[model samples]
Target: MSIKGKVAVVTGSAQGIGRGIALRLAQDGADICLVDMQIEKLQGVAEEIRKLGRKACAFQCDVTNRSQVFEAVDYAEKELGGFDIIVNNAGICITKPLEKISEEECERIFKINVFGVLWGIQAAAAKLKANKKKGKIISARSIAGHTAWAMLGMYSSTKFAVRGLTQAAAQELAPFGINVNSYCPGIVDTNMWTEIDHGCAPEKGVATGETWKASVAGIALGRAEKPEDVAAFVSYLAGPDSDYMTGQSVLIDGGIVYN
Candidate 1:
């Protein structure tokens, strides 16, 4: 599973699951390019990767922008000496009843969660092909993608869109030896979950923490997910061990939403 001396670009790497993936890849012997709008926090992650004895570069980027996404890939290859992996992990979660979903809210979530991944795929694929190298393109999906929750309908739709993109891109890029896949996480203990919990609380007529607790109770693993749990699976996808695996929207959500 060694990815030693490889270069990887991880978006939304300033915190949460993205940060975990970036650090794990570095610890496993890959130089990293940390991409996020949070420049200060991104630099902090870069410092941590450097401490792990891996080269790291922090690039401020808005993944929703096609031009910026392309630029980031180019910058990563130039600074890190090569590009072999890309994790399109930047996304926003929206919680609302289907009828209550406004057009603007729908667009906002899709732009970040869906279009961002598409742009990352395009940019990474173009770069890899230009360099005549094969690479991995990973994106963030969710258990909601597999099983659409009522209050999270919009967010679920975006994730489902990502799954479609992953499958299609995998087929299209396979001829070039490029693999494209997505990771589906469930009830992670991150700020995103905090938002989900709070958003569901009002609809459930319960306190914020209660919604979160109830959701976790359904997990067969009997615990809320940690960033490292998702990171571990992502590490496999980013490494050579998963070279033969592509077009998979894998659920790393304990035992929930089994496909």
Candidate 2:
């Protein structure tokens, strides 16, 4: 719970869920390092953190590009005093019918979602090793990764990969005292959903808040997730209390999966 002097790097922290995570961590006393492709937006999030009186910096990074990722992580370490926690929050989702899914689309999704997580892990592991501290590696995954969904085949596959990577990395890094885990959120009110909503097939019904609300009505808890909701969990993992939890995926799905 006490992370007063700790440092944390959150990928894709410019907005939505990632932004929520960054702000939560900053408020909890972690020196925040934000990574995102959009420099302008990243700057805004950085400014917000600074207003909270916390040290915050934003790095423009394309996680799919290994060289850029390496440089960004190094820059983060050098400029922000190296990070004590790595949040692999950068990811992408593409919805298409199985037959209509293109090879290019699949690769792009994997590059960002799966490979991106790998890049963050590789870069942060080195930083943690150099600092001689047992650090934490956390990522955002979706419930779609755990359960199969129609028309979300490509995204589901990538999510599954994220879950596997987290488990394997946990095993490999446990000896070094580094912890790795994944956060699985379900049907959250995120920009991703907004985009999907706007493009929903007419047969699926009009894209409205009521329709979206009904979609998740099957959940036992009866609610959609909020970015801040997930951010709170990210804070716990980055702090000391979750030091014992690693290489596991925590679901923030509002009991939808269980329901």
Which of the numbered candidates is closest to the native, going by highest TM-score?
Answer: 1
Deviation in Å, model 2, residue 132 alpha carbon: 1.5
Task: Provide backbone clash counts, one per model.
Answer: 0, 0
User: How well does model 1 score by local distance difference test?
Assistant: 0.94
Residue 46 of candidate 2: its Cα lDDT? 91
Mind giving the per-residue lDDT tens digits that candidate 1 earns over 1-259? 5999999999999999999999999999999999999999999999999999999999999988999999999999889999999999999988889999998998889999999999999999999999899999999999999999999999999999999999999999999999999999998999998999899999889997998898899999899999999999999999889999999999998777878
Report model 1's TM-score to 2 decimal places: 0.98
In terms of lDDT, which candidate is strongest? 1
Clashing residue pairs, backbone N/CA/C < 3 A, model 1: none
User: Ten residues in a row with the worst lDDT in model 1?
Assistant: 250-259
Please estimate how well model 2 matches the true structure, expressed as its whole-model Cα lDDT.
0.85
List the global CA lDDT of all models.
0.94, 0.85
Model 2 poorest ten-residue lDDT run: 195-204
Give per-model TM-scores.
Answer: 0.98, 0.94
Q: List the residue pairs that clash in candidate 2.
A: none
